[model samples]
Target: MTCPRCDAATIAFSIPAALRAHLPDDRPGAALCTHCLTVTPLDDPPDDTPSFERVSDAFPANDEAAVAFACVLALLDSLVLYRAELDAVATYAETHGADVLRALERLDADDGVDAHFDVARRTRQLEQFI
Candidate 1:
């Protein structure tokens, strides 16, 4: 599956073992991290959803389906919060980074000047990469 993040296509599939404990014993499946260990599936696959779809065969990224899902994820954050997330994304964008997902992790830091400092340094580091 195309990692819904950086779009680096890969066939690696399966959820992390830590989370598999929560999965139903009936089905044989896994949802491993294609990126970082940040976000969660939030729910099982829809009833009719197929196991895999070829990205190469799908519409271009400009299509409504792709943009809508992505935009919705982005709009879930405040502008400030969004930037903080982006700063994290920008950090990972350089080397082995998972930009979109990790960007939000910075928001989890304790509130105060220390948080701002961490954000700033990370922002600069991300900027260098971009």
Candidate 2:
């Protein structure tokens, strides 16, 4: 899976035993973005949906999809600092919509006046690796 924010490759990681009790039992693992250091909860893939088929369904031609794609690109350019491909952002926005994109923007925002400390910390780690 890719990082929802940066479209970077993600590594599957098991939730620590201590934290498992606080989460839903159905959550099997989490994915950590290599580039952005964002952690995402993961669930089992649905049985009926083939992954390849889902990939093919990502791009649906419609006005709403076009708007979402444009909005996501604007958000990435103005608000987000992480590197992301245009096609990947379009695909994600098409599938998830504007609300999810807004949430990601809020999570990654690092404005000097109202900094997000956790996001800044994670971003620092990414910078060090680069």
Which candidate tops TM-score? 2
Candidate 2 per-residue lDDT over residues 1-130, each given as its tens digit: 9978778765554433333333334264555444554446667433322221121222223434433332232323223343333334444444644333333344455232121135445334433322
Clashes found in each candidate (C-alpha, N, C closer than 3 A): 8, 0
Give the distance in Å from residue 23's predicted Cα in candidate 2 to where it truly belongs: 5.6
> What TM-score against the true fold does each predicted structure earn?
0.22, 0.32
Residue-level error in angstroms, candidate 1, position 78: 3.7
Quote the lDDT for 12 in model 1: 29
lDDT of 1 by residue, 11-118 (tens): 322232332333233232322222221122423433332222222212123222322222213323333445554443333332332343333233323231122124
**lDDT value, candidate 1, whole model:** 0.30
Q: Which ten residues in a row have the lowest lDDT in candidate 2?
A: 49-58
Best by lDDT: 2
Backbone clash tally (model 1): 8
Evaluate model 1: give its TM-score.
Answer: 0.22
